[model samples]
Structure formats: C-alpha cells, structure tokens
Target: MSVNTFNHRWASVILEALTRHGVRHICIAPGSRSTPLTLAAAANAKFICHTHFDERGLGHLALGLAKGSGERVAVIVTSGTAAANLYPAVIESGLTGERLIMLTADRPQEMIDCGANQAITQPGLFASHVTQSLNLPRPTPAIEARWLVSAVDNAVALQLQGTVHINCPFAEPLYGEWDNEEQAWSEALGDWWQESQPWLQQPQSRFSESQRDWNQWSQKRGVVVCGRLSAAEGQQVAQWAAILGWPLIADAQSQTGQPLAYADLWLGNPKAQAILQRSELVIQFGSHLTSKRLLQWQNACRPQEYWLIEDRPGRLDPAQHRGRRIATAVGEWLRQHPALPGKPWAQLLTELSSAAHTCIEQRLANEFGEAQVASRMSALLPPHGQLFLGNSLVVRLVDAFAQLPIGYPVFANRGASGIDGLISTAAGVERATCKPTLILLGDLSALYDLNSLALLRQSSAPVVILVVNNNGGQIFSLLPTPIAERERFYCMPQQVDFSHAAAMFGLHYRQPQDWASLYQQVTQAWQHGGVTLVELKVAETAGAEALRQLVQQVGAL
Candidate 1:
C-alpha cells in the first residue's frame, strides 16, 4: 500500500497552493501526527520554516510573521490540546485583520470520542474566529488531485479577511514515502503544475465606495486620525493632512506615531478639546485605536461628516456614528480622491498642541524615571530601527507622553491586548525583518512572556528590550480602588529582577540609572550586534502618580 505517498502528495498540493498565493513562511510545532505537514514543508525550497516546541508561542510567532511580512503565513500543529492553544493568536488575527493559515493534524476518523489519547473533535474547531475552515479525509485516490487543488484555492481566498483553518487527519504508518506515478493528474493541472500561480485566480473589486463627494468633503474643515497603519502609509497620511492643511492626530500603534502633542493628556484641556470639537469632518484611517480621549471626542462631538477608510468589511465604528465606512486601501482611497490646495484654516490648534508638549516636557524634565523615559521615547531609539509596543501601562504611557520616531514602522498586538506572548511576537518580528528592533514592555508583561526569551537568541538583528521594572502593575493606580485592597489584589507586585532572567537566557544585560545614560545605552545597543536587555527600575506608583498630576496641570491650562 502507498499510503505514505498519498499523505505526502496531499500535503504537497496544499502547500503549493498557499505558495502560489504568495505565502512563503511556515511555522511548525513538533508532534507525531503532524509529520506529513512538517516533512512536506521542510522538503519544499519555497518555504522559510520556523520551528517552536511550544504551540502557543508558535501561533503568536506566525501572527508576528504575518504582521511583519505583510503576507499570509501558515502554522502546522498536531491535533488535541495543541490545536486549542492556537485560539489566542487566532482571535487576535480575526480582530486585527491579519492573514494567518492554521494547518492542524488530527487522528483518523475511526478514532472516535469514546476513547483516544491524542484525538479530539476537529470540525468547526475555531468556530467563527477564522474566515474559512476545511477538513480533509485520510489519503484517498477516489478524490482526484484537481478537486483537492480547487478546495484549497477556494478556502484560501478568504484569507484576505482574516485566518483560515485547515484540519487534516492522518492514518498512521506516518513515515515512509512512495512513488509519484500512483496519483493521477488532469491535462489542466499539468499546465498549472509548471506555473507558479494559483490554479483558480479570483478577481477583486477595486473599491467599495465611489469618489463622488471627495471634493466637497476635502474642502470642509477636516481632521486626519490614524489607527495602526504601516509606516509608509502613516507618512503618506501625514503628507495628505499637510497638503489639506489639517492636523494629524495619530494613535500609539500608528507606524509613524505623531502623538498630536500627547493628545491623550491634552484632550483633557477645555481649550484644546474645544478646538478639536470644532472640526467639521473627521476621517479615521485603519482601526484598533489606543487613545480613549480621541475616541470619546469623536463620539461626543458628532461631526457633520465622519468617514472611516479600511479594506475590511464590518462595523469599525466604535463611536457609533452614521459615518461612511469606505472599504478600500488607504493608498487607493488617497489616489482616487486628491486633496485641495494647502489652506491654513486653524493655526491656533497647532499652537495649542505645541503648548501642551512644552508643558509636558517641563514637568518630566527632572530625573531618570519611567515618565521621563516615555516622554523622550521618540528620541530614544536609534535611527532606522523597528519598534514593538507592549500592552498595559507602557503602551498607555507612550500614547500619553511620547511621539514615536517618524518613518519607523511600529508593530503591536492590540486586538486582544493581553500581555501574554509579547516577547514571542517581538522575537518573531525580529526574525522576519533583520532590522534593529527596540522593544518596550512593563514588568508584568515581560514576566508573562519570559519563556519566549529563548526565541530572542536566534535573531540575526540587534535587539534592545527595555523592560521598565515598576515592581507591579502600575496601571492599577489610575483606577478608583481603595489603597488597602489594591496592593495584592489589583496591583500584584512581583519584585523579581530581570537581569537574572537575561543571564539565564544568555542575553546581554544592563541596568541604566539615569536618562542621559539610559538614552546613551539604548541607542548604542542597536549597533551592539546582539540581543541586549536594558532594565529601567522605578517605583510601582511612580508612572500613574506622575501622569495624574501632569494631566491635572494640563487641564488647568
């Protein structure tokens, strides 16, 4: 019996289809059942394979690869508990519109739910989280090769929206290979086999909305808002705003994070809020914004025209406005609708922004602390480097105080916003793009993804992980909780030093004392040619307390 050939051929066809559609990276987790997929991927010259022992980290690794490479990346894992571990990254991919393909290996059909060690129900496993799902039977010659190709093509087409889950059940003898002549192919497939293209090419619609009222909308008092855009796109949006004489208020996740002079803090100022509220039209590009004040302003102000430009379909409007959600690429939308001549409608808004920035700079000028570090974050990174922002207090701190370096692409997992797997995701990004990476995370987040530090040693790019050790969750201080109960319940302080962790992982470690030395070391680490861990220790209550007073003073303005 040529069962091994059948299984191998099926796996080859599936992988070939994915590559034809421009997927080049495959993340693999070790398991016996997933042998067909692992072997097939390793044998293929087209795929850049990444292997991880932990499936959970592997899922996030694929997510980060998709984010960094801007292509559909696949993951291979065995069935049972391994398949369930992929749920976190799958859910994140769904929310953020990342393209991920999960190929899980399951036990054959007869291994029923009654009694099986590593077998579980495979159908509809990811539920609605993935855009498409496909379950394949064990190697069968009854189904022609063309049918398999078409099925894979059909399923992968939906990857543009989000994730695609393909479950393959392998009947064992999972080892030895066989001859190619056993499987039959059609004349059409013979032509397809020679070409490096998808068997079925589907046409895509150019755009969702027409360019009918672009001129009218462009002439109004418009404002540009950004949420999680690529660096190049954000810069173009910045240019578009400048050409139209509108102010650009970008979120923390935006590739080129022009912080709108710390919009999160300054928006509390009545004078600043009033000027922004006067905006007649608001055009928000992308989704998953980080600024609560800006989102609140959009909801409360209720501008005459609010247009959201995104490629994906669904309700991206958190403001719940009767706004037009234009389903199109930002570049295409900008191309179709050219802006009018540069006209300075409100120059005072720029002055207000500058004033707010000056007030923040003067306040945090004293010592080398978390707030100071975050405030000067834009200047902290070395030129031509990449960034990954962590969740919890650090991201909020950056959003509130720092303006990210212009033209440097920033990546984050804001969809789920959980602190877990952050280091793994960042390590994946570092591997995908061989550029110097600067990573910022709070103590708790660093601890949560501590296991992922092992992934860091493999990256060829220079990495600087700036762990702001606040000893606990500083975000709790912002909430209205009693001081007594908040200590252990809410804050959860873990006073473990990360230098020991860095040493255990064989990474270079440093503890920068002051801002001048901190900035010097961080920027220098980019040229250091290896992974360096830089820890900036501060009191647990420092960040939350400083921010409160800073905003209070800004509000008084």
Candidate 2:
C-alpha cells in the first residue's frame, strides 16, 4: 500500500521496523490520535494485532505475551491517560526483566501545555521503570527517514535490558490521504523496504562467575531455594539440587515439579524448622518466593553464608543476606562447576514435609473448599498445560496446598503482585503458549479485570477459569482488622455470582457445588477447546479459617 501523508509514511516505517525487529504481536487500544499507527499495524501482515478497549488490560496482555513467549511484545495506545495506564505493566516488566515495547501516541509539541484535548506530558511518564524512553518529533521532510528507523532499531535493542518506551507525537491531519507523493518518499528506501532484516542488530552480552567462586560456594551445607524461574531453568536447578543433595525449596511459581512437597508447611513446624536451621549456607536461584513462612524461616536460620545466582540485573535479596550475588544464568553456573556428591542436608526436613503433606490430605479429603479446589486443580491440571495463578489468597492457597505437578508450567504476576490484570495476563499466556491454560482467580480479582474476559475469545487453546467466589476479598479476613468492621472495610463482599459474567463473555459457565462437579467441569473444559468459567462458591470466612486450622495442624506436627 502506498502512503501519501507524512503521518501515514511515518506510521508505515515504524510498524515495518517493529516487525523486522522480531516483534510478532502488538496489543492496541482504540483512540483517534493513534489511528494512523493502528491502521498501519492492521495492514502489516507480519504483525498480529490485538485490540482491547482498556489500555490497562492491553498493557498486561503484552506483558503476558512477553513473559510467556520469551520474546519482545509491543503495545500501542493513545495519549493522555491511555499512556499513563501502561505504567503498571511497564513497572512489572522492568522489575521482572521482561522485554516490552511501548509505543504511545501523543499530540504535537505545540499542543502540549496549551490545554489541548488528549494531550499531556508524554515523555518520561514511566519514570525509572522503563529501560529506555524516547520522544520522537512529528514526521517532517527535514528529518531523515533513516533516523526514525534507526531510533526504532536502538529502542528495540535496548528492550533486551527491559521495556522500551517510544512516545510518538503527530501533527494535525493524523489520518490523511494516501497518495503517490508519500509513496514516492517511501520508495526512496529502495531495497530497504523489501528486506526482512532489521535496520540495526545489536549483540546481546552475558555475565558469568569465576570457577573458583563456584568451587568454594558449592562445598557448604547449603539449601537450594528456587523462586520464580522458567520451566527449563527450574529443571536445570532441580538437577543441580539433586546432584548436590541439597533440599530444593521451590516457590509455587517456580514450576520445579521436584521441589520438596509441603516445604512451606514444614517450615512452619518447629520440628522441621530445627532441621532446616542446621544448614550453614543458602543458595537461592530466581526471585520472589510466595511463602511468607519460608521467608521467615530463611531469616530465622541466618545461615553463615547466603549466595544468590540470578542472571537478571537487580536486587533479588531484599534482606541483604546474600553474601555473594552471582550474575549469571543458573544453567551456565551449573555447567561451569563440577558436581560434588555430598551428604543429604535436608533429609529430615524432607521426611517432615511428607508428614505435613499427609496431614493436609487427610484434612481436605472429605471437606470440599477453596484449598481443596486448589489441591484438586493442581493434581488434575494436564501435564503439558500452563497454570496462571491469581495473587492474594488464591496464590497463597496454591502455595500451601497444591502439589507440584510434573511438566506443568506455572505463571503469575509476582512482580507487583496486584490482583489487577490477572485474566488479561492469562489470556496473553494462552496466546503465546497455545497450550491448555488454567487460571485460578478470586471473585474480586476476576471483577477487577472483567473486561479481559473478551480477550479470552481469541484464545487458540482451552482456557479454564476457576473463579473461587467467596463473596469478596477474603484475604482481608486474615488481617488484624476488628471482626465487626472487617466486612465493611476489608472484605467488601460482592454477593454476585460469575455465571452471568461467563454468559456475557460467551464462555461456558458452571457453578460447581461439590468436588465431583468441579473436577468434571475442569475435565470437560480441558477436553473441549474453548473458554470456560468454573465458579467454586464457598463461605467468605471459610477459606481464612481453613488456612488457620491447617497451619495449626501442621505446627502441631
């Protein structure tokens, strides 16, 4: 297609450069100012564009895609609050080291600070969260087209570090006529337009530790703690843990199937704590463990030495416990060091964990509740499927109850750990993996991103959404708020059900009244390829009380 106006020409080059730079998917939110970019993305066959009415959801959708596919994903939105809406996702991407390209459209320089509609200070909006931020001038004959392309190339290259924000401001006639004049200007590119290669390609760099450091670090009686890791990375860490005879304390989001079962529960018990505290060193890979009890145990143990192996550049240890932080991939660290067979350091804890798991099983055997549902879902999820866990109570419940299923990948937005955008993020994961995905969210969380249900319609694989409806934010029930004021202040109960929501989103809805029905619904959803909402209705106070009772039982053991 020939572009006539400068806006059309600029949009074409930007979108074309993004595709050439290997951005396969683009999430777009509708607005007038961003029409040119949106239209250009739609016309480009190399880009798969997803439209969302809400920019907040759109940003998270791109985040999900980036995390799930392990590739850079772009998000386009209009000026003003639309760009501001992306701040949360940008913050998450920065913290998690995910590659995201944010293309925000804005008004021309003259329109800024003049009380113009849909115009705001678009530059540096994301603050320190973005890896790179650039404000591009409006397209003009004075500026070389190569400059624009090169800017895109550099911005995308910088995304290797984190999210890249490019604020593009367009002049009047945002959507102008496409004529031969613009086509002639574009033709000046000659062979560049037809080439599949990026205008600029930058090599990525890696960092590793000295073999002597590893040799010294590996000999200590250390425990292996795996936090949020990719499935492949988790497997490598698990293998290293087995070779070293170290106890692997895998977080729920670690996706390490071989982690010590009920490690969190065991840590809460005094007997198990005594065994774990004997360790002289702690080697942690990955970041953001979901268990507070486990974190407390780490602090209480106060090991003589703590080592953190993480490739990402950030402070993974908030407690300043890691004496040495090795900035390298876990696999690379494993490859550099020779395996040393040592005596089992966590055997007693492992034995105690087994008893804890058995106690949990007996407690939930006859009782069907939120924790039971999480346990059942953990066992029932397909080996090849992906599990997207919601934050707050749902993630805690899974961490405490769900057994790690082999070959099943687990994902969550643990960076910010907010309840917002759970559904949209899961949809993005489904889009990227093309695998059966199960999302376990709470009633309040589901409502926070309810509009994201529309995104599920585009899923290519089965997506079973298990909404544990206990009225409202039941997590508040566990807090120290007075019981009389808890409901009005903390657990704001939303008595509404999710069946109507499922119907509204064209998803198959099932209100499972018992464990059998819940399992049957999930199985059907997994077998059938579409979106399904399985709502588990339980008492609002029941989940909190159940957790309290379980903790008591495990502590007594």
274-327 per-residue lDDT for model 2 (tens digits): 777778778888988888788887666688878888888766887888478887
TM-score for each of the candidates: 0.96, 0.96
lDDT of all predictions: 0.84, 0.84
lDDT per residue as tens, model 1, 23-64: 898999999999988888998899999988888999988888
> Any idea what lDDT model 1 has?
0.84
Question: Which residue ranges in model 2 land beyond 4 Å of their true spot?
Answer: 1-4, 182-190
Cα miss at 499, model 1 (Å)? 1.6
